[model samples]
Target: MIVGGQLVDEPSATSPGTFVSVDNGVPLSATNPAGSGDWTGWSITRSLIDGLPALFARNAATGALY
Candidate 1:
């Protein structure tokens, strides 16, 4: 579980989860799963500086943008 964009781990198994903010400290997406194995669905995005073009990539698992 995420809270504020940083990974967190606890010992008692009752502590809150961690958060991960994306896009330069911007909140992009969030997820809360019941079980774990291979959390799929993600995407990616490339940005341009001045005149260059940006490229965006998406995957089949998490649908996350990078």
Candidate 2:
């Protein structure tokens, strides 16, 4: 799916990828959440946000990321 003009692919469950849900609407994420590997917080991406897996749920009424 396309968010914030960026491209994201829900290729698989084990490798569902990553995404950031901004309260005000900004998107940044990974293509593989499970294999995101080691990190040191040097990345300038959004933190404390829910990342959707290949199999995810969304609220239809508000289009909220759940």
Candidate 3:
């Protein structure tokens, strides 16, 4: 998937190579009702935001882009 003209991918539940992956629209936080590390429906991208390289992701379930 793509966000803000940047390229993204949902290759697997957890990152194929590194880091944490949360489910689409599923909140991953200390106080999340669904707990943590349980959601994995996210579209992730490594790109430039505000002219700086950053990692971006979208929550498929909630339409949250961050």
Candidate 4:
């Protein structure tokens, strides 16, 4: 899981090195799935949006939530 814009492993996450978006706010073009190619993220820093800290990304292929 990518929490707070930093990759983190969930307590019961069965798969490793996998990530998905917990919220549906992320756009379709913003994602880079791991299996699609590799090296999905870079300079993934957290930024403020509408005076709120928000960071969103995901692999639409997974269709699973952690």
- lDDT leader: 3
Ranking by TM-score: 3, 4, 1, 2
Local accuracy of candidate 3 as per-residue lDDT tens digits, 1-66: 443333334345464665334334232332222333333565666887899989765667887776
- TM-scores for the candidates: 0.24, 0.18, 0.36, 0.25
Clashes of each: 20, 3, 8, 0
| Pairwise TM-score winner, candidates 1 and 2 | 1
Q: How close is candidate 1 to the true structure, as a TM-score?
A: 0.24
Candidate 3 vs candidate 4: which has greater lDDT?
Answer: 3
lDDT of 2 by residue, 1-66 (tens): 444333243233343464333333433353323233221222223334366423443333344342
List residue ranges in candidate 4 displaced over 4 A. Answer: 1-6, 9-41, 56-66
- Candidate 1 lDDT: 0.40
Q: CA lDDT, every prediction?
A: 0.40, 0.35, 0.49, 0.43
Q: Per-residue lDDT for 1-66 in model 4, tens only?
A: 443434443343357844443453333333343435432443333569999986644444554221
Best by TM-score: 3
Candidate 3 regions off by >4 Å? 1-39
